[model samples]
Target: MERLFGLDMQLIADTLLTAISVFVLFTLASYLFFDTVRDVLKKRQDRIKSDLDTASKEKSDALCYKAEYESKLRDADKEVEEILSAARKKALQNESKIIDEAKEEAARIIARANGEIELEKKRARDEMKKEMIQIATLMAGKVVAASIDEKAQNLLIEETLNEMGDETWLS
Candidate 1:
């Protein structure tokens, strides 16, 4: 090759230097790409960790809410048991009172019946005694009025004189 432009050596040297600079630039660009990719991956990991932390917190909150609900349910159950116990006691008391009242009423009715029966018996006995006395007095008066004095005197005195002569006939 002849020096046609009188710059043949300088052109060849400049072409070599341009080739080296392009190679260095390509290497530096590849390194920058790798570093940026690493940074993006780290950021993704941090984001994922934050998301996991939030999930754990939510789970704990849910557990707390469930525990609170269970506690409230237990309290409500205890209250219900107490209410039932009170209701049962009240019902028993009412039943006892009702039974006592019924017994009292029964006793009163029996006492009243006994008193009425006694009164009836007394009235009947008094009426019977009064009737008996009246009948006895009437019979005694009739008997005495029919059986006394004049008849007795005539029969005794007249019959004795007549019977004195009849002694001969008797022999």
Candidate 2:
């Protein structure tokens, strides 16, 4: 029953008892809920780790698909180039063939025209020769009818035949 500050021994004992009771209550609450809170935290960490793993796998899949599409695009470009090259080669060959045919046809036409020209020239020479022969015969008849003596006429005809040359009427 020693009082240091005018406080009663009963009041001090009641305060001490209340403090001890509150400490006990706190210890019991910690004991009961500590495992439940730890379990909830562990579950949340596992769920976050699983979501991160899924995101990583999806990223890897997307990268693989992108690489595959790029490879296909390159192949398609090569195929298109090959097709264009073949078409160009074929077109060049066709152009050369057409040019060669045109040259051959032109040569044939020129040769035919030359042959026709030669034939026409020969025909003109033959007609001129025939006209010359008819005129010479008419002139000779007129000269003979105008002559009064037969001997003079026969001599003149022989001299004219000699001057005309041997090959003039032979062909």
> What TM-score does each of the candidates earn?
0.53, 0.56
Tens digits of per-residue lDDT, candidate 1, 16-125, equal: 99999998987898698867988999999999999999999999999999999999999999999999999999999999999999999999999999999888777776
Worst 10 residues of 2 by lDDT: 162-171
List clashing residue pairs in candidate 1: none
* TM-score, predicted candidate 1 vs. hidden true structure: 0.53
lDDT of 2 by residue, 46-146 (tens): 99999999999999999999999999999999999999999999999999999999999999999999999887766765765666666556656777768
Winning model by TM-score: 2
User: What's the true lDDT of residue 167 in model 1?
Assistant: 43
> Against the hidden true structure, what lDDT does model 1 obtain?
0.78
